[model samples]
Target: MRNVLVPLSCAALFSLGPTVASAAPEDGRPVADPSSSVAASGAAARLAPLTLSVAIERAMSAHPRLRAAVLDVEASDGAVQQAALPPNPSLAFEQEDTRRDTRTVTVLLSQPLEVGGQRAARTALARQGREVARADLDALRAEVRADVVQAFFSALIAQERVSAATESLRIAGSGADMTARRVAAGKLSPIDETRARVALATARVELRQAEAERVAARHALALATGQEEAAFVTLDGGADSLPGLPDEADLARRLSDAPTLRRSRLEVDRAQAAYELERARRFPDVTVSLGAKRSQELGRSQAVIGVSMPLPVFDRNQGAQREALKRRQAAEAMAEAQAYRLRAEVLSAAVELRARVDEIDALRRDVLPGAREAHAAAMRGFELGKFGFLDVLDAQRTWLQARMQWLDALMKAHRANAELERRLGAPTQQP
Candidate 1:
């Protein structure tokens, strides 16, 4: 993925005019030639086109949320390291005086050792926690990518709508011109011209609406890409042709990689590890220390060792272990529920996608052309004085309505395509 940024290097090189060598100074300081440099630097500040993929990559690299998530991973890694380390050593010093003159001093060092695999258990728990955090970061990245994809598609759809509206306006204008010519030739009533003008006005309104939608879509794309408005550009690719629905077996395989499902599974693993850690705590950890001591009366040094262990007389971690177990059970249930929901969503989206594609095909092939032919016939009849202005107006209205329906069908097909891609965890194409 290329980072979305203007090529300042190119701009600088292109913006600089012919560079002139500076004349040497006689007084030990050279005069600066800043004309070319200033021009180059100014040009480097101009906006450049950025594509959707590039924008997404740049945002992923620079986004504050992703950076924060990365920091959390590092913090969790540090926690794991701390858990793996042994307890700090202990040190002691003693001094004694005997027989009014003799004195002895001793210094001792001791290290406390963890017992009952406490270090290993704690490290395991920390490792699991780190995994959970990493999974969370992955989920966030996927969400960001999905948003960028959707925004890019929406912008493309808006552009297409604008194009369609522009064409409709042209058609309406042509209709108005034809009506005027017929009225001047005394072949049609003035009421027909009025109707045609009304249609043209409606077309202009639709064009304005389409333009507004395109502007809004561009803004959304800018937000998703973390780019300035001037840097926004059209996506490079068109909508991908709808693919055949996946078989049940294939869909099952693909579902494993779904971010939601994967996150839920990781949560289950984390909960299970937490439960085990709690259980391990039921066996108390022992701390042992060894040291050396000196006696002033005997003028001798002796080694001393001590061991301490927390007795599970009162709190055996039973309550904590039970709570952890319950949480683990809940996590498992949640994972199962997510899996079910994902399956349903994938299936539903697939069904809807197929229906939308079929409808678009039917509208394009059967309905729109028929309406256009009927409108042409009605226009010819009115010009020949075989029909009234009302008949021609009605036919034009029907044709316009059909064209709008066709545009709507296209939009639905695109929307369904987006939904299917989202459900399948597929990467979106350029448009």
Candidate 2:
């Protein structure tokens, strides 16, 4: 059996079939490097076509959502830096007795010391927060990659549909021309010629609709790639370029390390660290002061030292500690729930991918060949005056329907594969 599809005779179905490509990368980065080629179309300039890799790379490099996620990571880094800093020291000056000989001045410098491990706990929490932000960035990157892949395939499908419609229009026009000639020669009824014209008109309308859909799909692909306008009019790829699906066992093996689950786990760690930091706050920090005092009356200088600390009276961070603990619990629950949901989704996508692959195989191997043969036979019989024009129309419709269904199956298969890769956290090798 052919892996892609067989071309029909006059209809030329699957002649320009859609393609699928890998959206996930092995190293968890964007699929391909960005290229500076393929600029937006000018008034008379023809833009170069884009490959799937270029489109994905452009999205990863320029997509606003990804930039926002990177900013979150940078913000978390700032928080970590702030958390590591020691408390600022205070300098105080006092003056008393404005009389000439009774004037006294004292200079005091005090520094708060973190004796309760609050700095360590705070810094740990901030680092964990940064990890959570990084995880979020990774998750967002994976999502963007999948979105680009889906949009790319959608455009490819639209392109193929326009080709199919154009072929149908040609076939319909040929049938109409043949019927009109036969009617003029008095070998066919006037109604047969009318029916042929109606089919031709319908084909024209279908072609127009398909062309519109292709335009919409191109716009969607541009948006997905973070472009302000559709930059390229064509895509570079071939049919059946998609990687094969891994078995259920492989998907199960990759489930635990999914990006979403990793983010959720990081959230739990951050919440636990926050709880520790809050508990550390229950012990008040101490301030130590050291300075020199000068007396105008005595005409001498003396050194002074003192220490102070809060008694933790009435506010031992009880509320904050409780909140942090509750949040930690919530994070744990959420992580568990996410793991469960991800497992289910991966399995579902695997099943869907398998089914679509099988359906596509059946259609190519068993259905399309028969439909093409039937349509060709009906056309021949109609020309020989052994069959009605309606018989030819029915066969043509059946063939068109089969082709559309095959396209639909291919679209679904591409989607399922993209979803499966996204959930797997990384690209799997074809088996």
Candidate 3:
């Protein structure tokens, strides 16, 4: 197998994470840590939280899809070897009644000679095909990394929601306690106390729902990392701060480096190589035979040498060459289409990321703080009997909604930035 270059890893945490890259493959596959033997042993030590970079590496090292793709590189390598070899020589023996005093015996050897660079063409085509597969592996690696990031953040956001729900439940419980006391003191109506109890019940329901979502998210993250649901141990990150993204100008340049584009380019090269191979095949090879003929009647041996070749009168490979040309044309068109599609994808992701950033900023910088202050004031006013219990309930609802919305926006922004990281082929704040 040819040397396979593993695509660089996108270890940026919203452009802030560490860079953890896999080394290039010597035989068209990333060399996994031979100590993946450690996975079985340290699998027990995974009781601690799993970080995103480590998770991505683990997925690459162990994912079944990644391992299967490596086999293609190996198969292509075998094909290249086969294509580079000369045809094996054939040996034959014959006995005939010569219509003379003695029977005749003969031995013949024949070797097919591949001329017009057919072997070279076949080898080149196979090499180009191997390149296409390697590029595909790089693309798959990028996909796996992107999926890990998305799933990790999904779990993180679910965690944040659970926290928000837990905090809301605590506030609701506190409110209910105060309402019961006010009713006993004849300062608040019993009907209002019932409303406070109902509000507490709703908060408990939301908390349960949030917890369920968190559990589901964890399961999903585990699956994305190629583990059992129970195997992730724990997720050790928060979604409080989304990482920054690269600007459009920089992203445009980076986007061209994406594996999808590189793979498309390789496709074109392979197509051209195929065409060359077909063109080389249009020229026929020669079969040369050399042997010794023995005749017992004469008690003599004769050496014979001869060559045979197919005439180009018919089946000149024009049809196959035409097919190869058409395929090459299609490959070129597809390459162009792939480039355009990548540009569109980068532009779209950048636009959405900017909007999410603005939305999250407004919610955090303005909406959330005001909502918090309003909820706090409502609590203080209710304690002083200056505001109705209904007013406190409304404020609490508003505050919870604002916090959840802010968390949601932050998740979106992170996801959009992750898309940028995928489309641009990598993420590092320094870039």
- Model 1 segments more than 4 A misplaced: 1-71, 92-110, 181-187, 239-244, 294-301, 379-389, 428-431
- Candidate 3 on 168-283: residue-level lDDT in tens? 99999999999999999999999999998999999999999999999988887887778777666777776766667677678867877888999999999999999999999999
Residue 109 error, candidate 3, Å: 0.7
In candidate 1, list every pair of residues with a backbone clash. Answer: none
Candidate 1: tens digits of C-alpha lDDT, residues 308-333: 87788999999999999999999999
Model 1 lDDT at residue 380: 85
Stretches of candidate 3 off by over 4 Å are 1-44, 98-100, 428-431
Per-residue lDDT of candidate 2, residues 66-142 (tens digit): 99999999999999999999999999999889986999999999999997799999999999989989998888888
Predicted structure 2, TM vs. truth: 0.86
Off by over 4 Å in 2: 1-46, 228-230, 428-431
Q: What is the C-alpha RMSD of each candidate to the true structure, in Å?
A: 10.2, 17.9, 15.5
**Per-residue error (Å), model 3, residue 180:** 2.3
Clashes of each: 0, 0, 1
Candidate 2 lDDT at 172 equals 100
Candidates in descending lDDT order: 2, 3, 1
